[model samples]
Target chain A: MNIFNYELKINLKSSLYYLLGMIALTSLYLTFFPSFSKDTSAFINLLEGFPPEFQNAFGIDLKNILSIMGFYAFILFYILLISSIQGMNLGVSILSKEERDKTADFLMTKPVTRSKILISKLGASITIVLITNLLFYLVSYMSINLIIEDTFSFKVFTLLHLSVFLVEMIFLSIGFFIGVFLKKVKSTISISLAVVFSFFAIGAFAVNASDDKMRYLTPFKYFDTNYILKNGTYELSYLVVGIVLIILCLVGSYFIYVNKDIDSV
Target chain B: MASNIIEMKNLTKYYGKARGIIDITFNIKEGEIFGFIGPNGAGKSTTIRTLLNLIHPTSGESTIFGLDTTKYPAKIAEEVGYIPSEIFYYDNMKVKELLKYSASFYKKDSKKRMAELVDIMELDVNRKIRDLSLGNKKKVSIIQGLMHEPRLVILDEPTSGLDPLMQQRFFDLIMEENKKGTTVLFSSHILNEVQKISTRVGIVKEGKLIKLEDMNTLREKTYKRVLIESSTPIDDNYFNIKGTKDFKTVDDKLSFLYSGDINLLTNKLSTLKVHDLLIEDPDLEDIFMHYYVREE
Candidate 1:
């Protein structure tokens, strides 16, 4: 419990900063919505002038560019990219910092099992993601309602925001697993940025745009906003894939971390 | 009978293909300060890390407090305090906050003991960890290690960054804890420092335990560092005899470490026309060299 509380205390400040950054970004993007909605066709024609791949790359949906929820969905792409970075940074740093800083000997020699330490760190991460998602949901909901007058589907809006949290979970798990597997991590942000950008790029250039199987490749493509708008629910297979990926990453991390030799040399 | 507090049976570790420790076996008594002595890269840290369960042995069994270290490290750690050679803590944390976090690991209320250690170490608790010097960080490690008042304290080259005055105070503090029946495992490469504290000593070389002897017996052994200035340059092999090692000659001065019968050494020395002679007990460096030269 002490370990859990200590980890939470350390992570709390940075996570709040991430939340504030997201809120600021969402507000800034939504302010432009009132004016952007005025001339949707002109903007859509401007975007339509680009190649199909380019349009897909930027997540420009011509059909729903006028509605407030659709505009928010476009904004969610950037949020997903940013929060994934935040999640990856948190996961990588929380577990690997002790080794990076050469403090593993101090913490490992204490009267706590390795499993307990890992669990405490994992729990703190979950709590951070949970708190961030909740506050983000509340903030986005109120701000969107206040900024735009056009009626939009509440369910689709909720699902769009929910996808951000889901993607963050997968990235966090991947970061955690990488944290345990690597012997030395010189900089957490470098690893986080490198990984998140790679996935973002993979999702940007879809191998087969029509193929559902390609969605499993990158977490960024898992929840299609177009699909969410049309069906009002997530792709079940992608949700299962995300959960399974998270479990595999975390469980693999646990086993490797427990038996790992914390070599000082 | 003083039951063994730590026991190892053929403990060996290999980092991939490189050797860490090889067939090292020894026991530390319940209340004795066991000095683990060896040169750098000689597996002193490896052995200590195995005992602390920081690394698993490649093959072997070790028990601390009569509990299997691999299976019951947490239980063993409850009564053990360890100060690593390299001290590190959260960079953003204040000294007081880090110490309190460390104190929270144990079940005991260490507030009073923490206060006393802070006073004795003369540490400024308000200082951030990143702002402190190496010596100050070491003081933090010492205080945190002892705050819980654990039964067995293991120190690995703990005096490197400490000043002479602080080192003396640290030894005095360890002795005080020893008087209260806290067993200590002090590991160092320096001979005199370990000699000053350890009741028994174990010497390791090339990942192997070469010798384990009582501190008094090891001190009282026949080993002596002999230095002589001869009137004329003597033959190089003239002093070579049983249990003599590291023989070297510079101009007319001859030096060697001898652990043979004192009478034989004296009888040979009487034949030499010596201008100046000095015989002193061998320090750990010379003694370690003596063991290394003998086995090959």
Candidate 2:
């Protein structure tokens, strides 16, 4: 319990920064929605001029371009990118920072078990991600209400928010797996950015190709916001796959961390 | 029948193909300060870490307080305090916060001991760890290791960055702990530090325990340097006797190392007109060299 509390306290400040950064970014984009909706037809006409491949790559849907949900989904593509970066950065840095800072000897020599150490760190990361997503949902919801006077389906907005959380979970587990397997991560942010961006790039290519199998490769395509907006639920196949992947990564991380030797610096 | 506090039987560790420690076996009795001495990369830290369960042994096993080390590291660690050669802590935390965090591991309340140690070590608890100098950081490590008042304390080259005055104070602290029946296993390459307090010592070289003996026995059994000034020129074979080695004659003087009876040497000197004579105990470096050369 002490390890858990210590880890949580150490992670709290950075997590607050991530939460504020996400809120500020989402609010900045939300304020532009009211002005953009007035010129919806003009914006749709401009989007139509672009090639189909470019439109698919950027997740632009021409048929639903006039609705608020469509605009939210379009902006959400970038939101997912930023959220995944935060999750990956947190996961990788949480475990690897001890070794990078050469404090493993101090921590490992304690009376706590290795499994406890890994679990405490994992719990801290999960808590931070959950808190960030909750604040993001509340802030985005309030901003959306402030913008328009008409009614919007609360269910559709909720499904879209759940998709963001799902994608972030996949990225966070991947980052954690990398940290456990790599032993020492010198530049955590750079490695995390590279990995998150590569997945985003691959998701873009999958969009252009429109291949069903390619969707399995990138976490971004797991919960399609367009599908969520229309069907009002996540795809079962992708959701199952995402859950299995997270479980595997987390279990593997604990196993490797417990058995690994901590060499003196 | 007193039990051994620590027992390692044929313990060996290999980092892939490279040797870490091999076929090492020794036991430290309770309430004794056993010194582990070796040069750089000679596997002093490797043996200590293996006992601490920081690194898994490739073969064999070690026991602390009669419990398997690898299987029950946390249980063993509850009563053990380890101070490494290089000290590191969370840079974002203040000294008091770090110490408090370290104390939270054990089930005991170390508030009083922590305060006492802080005063004795002359540590400023309010300063952040990143703002501390190396020696000051070492002082923090000492306080953290001893604040819990553990039954066993293991230190690897613990006096590297400390000044002479601090080193003396640290030795006094360890002596105080040992007097309270705490077992100490101290590792270092410097012979003087170990010689000052150790009851028994194990010398390692090339990943093997080459010698283990009581400090007094080791000092008494090793060779002694003998120098003699004769009034007249002496024959080269005049002092030729058993246990006399490295014999050299310069002018009317003769000097050599002797490991045999001192009375026998004095008997030989009485036969000659000895102007002056000096027999001195050899330093630890000479003893270490003799062991290495003899092993080769």
Among the numbered candidates, top TM-score falls to 1
Tell me the alpha-carbon RMSD of every candidate: 2.8, 4.0
List ranges where model 1 is wrong by over 4 Å. B228-246, B258-285, B291-296
- Full-model lDDT, candidate 2: 0.87
For residues A135-217, could you state the per-residue lDDT of candidate 1 as single tens digits? 99999999988998888888898899899999999999999999996667789999999999999998986733777677688
TM-score of chain A of each: 0.96, 0.95
Model 1 clashing residue pairs (backbone):
none
Residues B1-296, model 1: lDDT tens digits: 98999999999999999999999999998889999998899999999999989999999999998999999999999889898898888899999999988988899999999999999999999999999999999999999999999989999999989999999999999999999999999999988899888999998989999888888987665478899998966888887888787888888899998888889988988988999999987776777666545555
Against the reference, the lDDT scores of all candidates come to 0.90, 0.87
Each model's DockQ score: 0.76, 0.67
* Each candidate: chain B TM-score: 0.86, 0.82
Candidate 1 has a TM-score of 0.93
